[model samples]
Target: MANVNEPTTNYVILTPEGVLHGFSQVEPSEQQLALQAMLAPEQTMTAHEWVERYSEIWLDMFIEEGWVEVVDKAIIAPHVQLDDFLRYVSASLSGSRRVAIGSDEGFCLAKMGFTQQEADTLCVAAADFFDFLKRQQQRGWAVHGHAISFFSTIDMLMPNTSFIFLWINNQGYWIIIEDEPLLNNRAFVELVWGIKATGERFNLLAEQVLDKKAQLESDQQAQAEEQKK
Candidate 1:
């Protein structure tokens, strides 16, 4: 990583179009400066490696909650430690997507070519949760029909990390949370489809998978019980 304050050494960027070189300038615009930082990994990582890095972190979250399974498949043996995976997929997928991280610190997304495995894993998860989300939606979770485009999901790839994403349309809005995937298998789905969730690892994992209706119902029940006391 090069300091923005000083000149960055020669670097490359893996963009949606293709791999590109950075432009040398006496004073790069603010956007170019920011872009240099965003493309940091490309200076070292190939497109496939970048996607693998992101997927590994995202999968680790699910692994913690027993939502996913991992087979080493390494020629030698188990190579995946917390930081290292023994065998890595050699090919990068054809499509491109942006993965960004958010917190009090700030926000950043990696622009890279995604792998097929990465796309499949998320698609499967999103489809699974979409079933539950559709059920809740019919019961008035969203505006009944907001014409939302289910493009791609941006998982907040940090453990015990909390993030807020707001989607606004002509009809209404949705506040989606993507926390560690311990609540339920559908957590990845919910996070993918922009469903409301209590992304709290402190609570029982079962209790954490509350759709909008479930969450509201639980709140009402708690309020009623409190009144009785």
Candidate 2:
């Protein structure tokens, strides 16, 4: 673990293709896992707080990674600036404990906690996903009905602001902000490890400040009734 003196670098890959998506009862072998991604610190970013982090820090990372380019004042949220897409990829699922990862080639698993190794793994995953998004853009695929727009090359013409692109899955996506505040504190969702948009499991987001599921269930039930009618 980096001898305690250096800043602890942990790897938190929010993907299910790892060594642990299946085999619920058994842990996969190390060779199947990204040993560098051990566990992330057990903290979550509250919905609004997550936005704050994006504005303050992560927005820059997204820019550096080619995920987004500061566009206009976030027409969505005033305090939160707007970001246009550079590349997009999405998928979804939620549930926690343990990290599993793999591509078409293989898979492995890691426990969810905090460690330098986990951070390193996350770093690699972040970089890989960034590249993946770029590839998807070049292919001219319409992701969520929108085409990719690379903003990194035109920073001189466009102002930089903090914004986040999100994750989507077979189900939907995880979002904390809406036109209206969902909670008394205005914190709809929180990401302990920053933003849990990896589309893997909700484990990273389950630890929450507000229970939005109650509303989700109600919406589902209402939709079911309407369908029957």
The C-alpha RMSD in Å for every predicted model, in order, reads 22.8, 20.5
lDDT of 2 by residue, 69-157 (tens): 23222212112111111001111111121222222111112212214465345434434544555587679853332111223345544
Predicted candidate 1 versus true structure: per-residue lDDT over 133-154, tens digit per residue = 5577679775322112342346
Report the Cα lDDT for residue 144, model 2. Answer: 36
- Maximum-TM-score candidate: 2
Question: Scored by CA lDDT, what does every candidate get?
Answer: 0.30, 0.28
Evaluate model 1: give its TM-score. Answer: 0.18
Question: Candidate 2 at residue 137, lDDT?
Answer: 66
Q: Which stretches of candidate 2 lie over 4 Å from their true place?
A: 1-94, 98-114, 145-188, 192-229
lDDT of 1 at 126: 38
